[model samples]
Target: MRLATGGIMHETHTFSAEPTAIETFDVARGAELWRYAGTNHSVGGVVDACRARRIGLLPTFFATAVSTAAADRATFEAMAGELVAGIAAALPVDGIVLTLHGAMVAEGFPDAEAEVVRRVREVAGPDLPIAVTLDLHANIGQAMVEASTVVVGYDTYPHLDAAERAREAVDLLVATVEGRIRPTMALVKPPLLPVPQAMFTALPPFKTLFERAHALEAAEEALVITIAGGFPYADVPMAGMSVLAVTDADIQRAERIARELADLAWAHRAEMVIRNVPPGEAVAAAIRHPERPVVLVDVGDNIGGGTPGDGTVLLAELLAQGAQDATIFIADAEAVRAAVAAGVGGTVETAVGGKTDDLHGPPVPVRGRVRLLGDGRFVHEGPENAGVPADMGPTAVVRVEGVNLVLTSRKLMPGDLQQLKTVGIDPLRQQILVVKAAVRWRGGYGPITRHAIDVDTPGLGSVDLNRFRFEQLRRPIYPLDAESTW
Candidate 1:
């Protein structure tokens, strides 16, 4: 059997000020795509699954960029055009597996992933069995469902199971092509908009809801159950929680289960609301807590949610509070360049962070000795993107008083421990670790963290939806509009 694979992956934060230039996307095609084979990303699972099944693989175009603002029309057209053209050239394949981020949005396209699928179907013919694996935060739409045969989403909120979900989708595609089962999927939107902080699979109402979905799957009532919390930053009609259920040639049954799960999420909407503490109070709480190493999550500067990595709100608070052995990372290429010029053991005075805009806070001037310099390339020491090599660009570490400011040239998610270790900072030894992320950092920092606290600063990735202005969202949404209802 011959199978083709690849797609564009991006998590668009429409409210964020960060612009996603075409150069930000990492594109790979043909035999060059094999580089992702052993990584823990979704594409790694596709490569691993095809190899395990002994199927001939046709690698196509794949493009992935970190969370950022919507792509321009020119960039979006180029990416989708290349993806469709690559699949068409592969031709005569038995099946296709696609890796996509469900929350992707472009300048004019609200449902970009669905648009890609539509274009692919137009070229590959309607009979091709196309299976897709999406991020758990995907805002799944009716258009996406109609364009593909099977869609599987990651089960974990920190997205630790990307490979596992990809394998599941590939297996289902194989079965569908072999005439073993016909997959029928149904979707339910429950008028809920929950933030990433509230959707951790290890906690609360989300955990219970996932348990129920898994129970149904174990009982054979559903072949696949995807509970996407949706991306609140994307101001689209489908920017809310969704429940999708797939059954064996049973559309009605899938619809019934999907509606049931959607209702369950609605009932727990209030409980799913995320509350964060102010940076000053959170730092005080972390100091008073009995834990040796507490993680202070800067929600406003969440790199995973498309916020600029240089927010200085929490860092200023940490400095004022006289916190000891605290560490924070700033994505300031200019600051790194300054540090590099000073060289190791040389004291450099430079403004760090908050350079993006006045939203995060003003850049704070600090004088620190340059401790270490690096190329900012390392493999992920993770249960997250394990075995995947990453580049943070030219990096430097500056020690300002009691805090170590690790500066990087690129915005990066704090999903792996090696990001810190590669810069000579031992995360375990620190009393407090301030990270630019929401909940995704738990996959890397959770092990050494004695406790974790979320801080509400001022930026796009704030847990409070009231902080943003939405022009495109449909009327009567939960939390955003108090009178909204299912």
Candidate 2:
């Protein structure tokens, strides 16, 4: 069976001032993006399942354009044009599978995933089966549902199962292509939940919800059951919790199951709340206990969540306290370039971060000795980002007195331990490790961290989505309006 694969994955924060241009994305074309975009572990398990079943795999093309900026209309159209053109060239295909982030918002288009699917369907001529896998934080819209036959979303928030969801999309596509099943999708958008960190499935109420969803999936009529705790930062009309169910030609069963799951999510909407502690307090808490490695999470400035990864709030606090043996990664291309020009062991003075959006904090000036430098490209050794070759440009490990800082030309999500090792900084030996991310860090840094604290550092990817005025979002979402009942 001939098939085409490609997608644009970005959890765009509508309030972020950073505009995602064509160059903003780490674009991997043709075969080069297979490991980074195609075979992620979250969807890897499904691919293995398909391989075990002896399904013919067609290598049409796979591209990943992940950016941490609010994509403009031009950027969205350009990406869509490239993906559509690529897929059209590989036409006469039996099926297509796309991996989407689900919360993307372009300048004029709120439902960017729908636009992509619409364009692909227009190219494929509607007869070909189209399937997609979405992040758990997908803000799925009616248009997206109308454009595709089958859609599957990640069950885990930290997204440990990205490969598994991709596998499921492939599995459903194979089934549909083989005429074994007619998959119909049913989606219900209730109210919005807080950031993913608060509603993690590894713990309590969420665990119960997942368990129940799993049980529902085991029922004879159900094919796929997914609860998308939507990404609140994207101010789209469909920005809310949704329950999607895929059933074998049974629209009634699909609708019933989806409604049941949506009702469950709505019942627990109040439970999804995030609280952040100041950076100074978090550092003090970490310093008090030297027995375990304390992870300081700079959530607001998380690059993975659509904020510039160049916040100096945490770094400034660490410096003020004269913290020793602490490691922090700052994405400042200027600083890295300056350090590389000065060469290793050379003393350099530069300003880092606070340059992207000064509302978060001002740039901190630092005079440090360049300890190590690299080309800023490395394959991730961690499970969360494994097999993905990341580029941080010309990076340098700078030692400002006793504090070791990682300065990079490219932005990183802080999910790889190899990121530190590549620059001669060991995270395991450090007393405190500051990561610019939300919960995804748990998959990589969980083993090394004695304790992980979610700190409130000011930036675009704020946990409190209400902090920013959202003009495009649908009104009466959760936390923003506690009295509203969806």
Most accurate candidate by TM-score: 1
User: For residue 99, what is the lDDT in candidate 2?
Assistant: 71
Q: Each model's TM-score, in the order given?
A: 0.99, 0.94
What C-alpha lDDT, on a 0 to 100 scale, does residue 106 get in candidate 2? 82
* lDDT of the candidates, in the order given: 0.90, 0.79
| Cα misplacement distance, residue 104 of candidate 1 (Å) | 0.7
User: What are the runs in model 2 whose C-alpha is more than 4 Å off?
Assistant: 33-61
Q: What lDDT does candidate 2 reach at residue 179?
A: 97
RMSD of each: 1.0, 2.1
In TM-score terms, candidate 1 sits at: 0.99
Judge candidate 1 against the unseen true structure and give its global Cα lDDT, from 0 to 1: 0.90
lDDT of 1 by residue, 1-486 (tens): 999998999999997777877799988988978998988889999999889999888999999988998999999999998889899899889998999999999988999999999998898888999999989889999999999999999999788999899999999999999999999999999888888888999997889899999999999999999999999999988888889999999999999999999999988888877788988999988877786789999988888888989999888888898888899999999999999999999998999988987788899898999999999999997789788778899999998898898999998989688898899988888889988888899998887889888898888788889888898887688888867777
Which residue runs of candidate 1 sit more than 4 Å off their true CA positions? none
lDDT of 2 by residue, 229-282 (tens): 787777778887778888999999889888887777777766777788988898
